[model samples]
Target: MFHYTKLDIFCNDVKKFADADGYVPEAEDICQDFSYPDTQFKGLKNWTQHIQSSVHATRSAQQKLHAWQNRL
Candidate 1:
């Protein structure tokens, strides 16, 4: 059985992979369209939230995929 600690490590790696796989940059591109482009405060905050949620959602999907694969 995979431990929860291992799952965390997997999620972290998934996040890194998501970054390298263009998930983060895509989020940045999307958030770039927001009104506060010049300011780091609101834009940064918005993109940060958006990117984090995106990565988290992708990671969860990957986790479910792996679980399903293992079950099969």
Candidate 2:
């Protein structure tokens, strides 16, 4: 039996499920078996819109995302 006393959410196993977008590290350069969720909205842009309107995204998080976008 195992006893758990701490909540360590940053473990590697948890990271695997952290992907909300269809970001394949190697989208087309190689092979992949992973699948990203798709709804009425398709592609990353639409998915982002859904998150923004429904998730009540914080300003700081939005600014960070904006910075990331600018880098690209």
Candidate 3:
């Protein structure tokens, strides 16, 4: 798991973590437009929520299953 104190750091870390883990997100799960407004913090908050969503959970499980199968 990755963690960061700052939102920018967190976002960057997510990308790195995903790449390192070979996490290929589904089309609808892409957050390429994430932008944090100078006056608000909704972008990062939304991203945080997105990763916790059921769809993401399903995708993660599928990835794990694939990896486990490949190992067999």
| Top TM-score model | 1
Between prediction 1 and prediction 3, which has the larger lDDT?
1
Reference-based TM-score of each model: 0.42, 0.24, 0.28
Structural RMSD, model 1: 10.2
Residue-wise C-alpha lDDT for candidate 2, range 1-72, written one tens digit per residue? 001111132122223322344222221221123344444445666545544532232333445556766785
- Report the C-alpha lDDT of model 3 over 11-64, residue by residue, as the tens digit: 333343242233523335545533333343247675556456534544455565
Give the residue spans of candidate 1 off by over 4 A.
1-42
Ten-residue stretch with the least lDDT total in model 1:
1-10
lDDT pick, better of 1 and 2? 1
Query: Which residue runs does candidate 2 get wrong by more than 4 Å?
Result: 1-39, 57-72
Q: What is candidate 1's lDDT per residue for 1-72, written digit by digit as tens?
A: 121233443445444423322333334355444333355436567667756765666568567768866985
Greater-lDDT candidate between 2 and 3: 3
Best of the candidates, lDDT: 1
Candidate 2 colliding pairs: none
- Model 1 has an lDDT value of 0.48
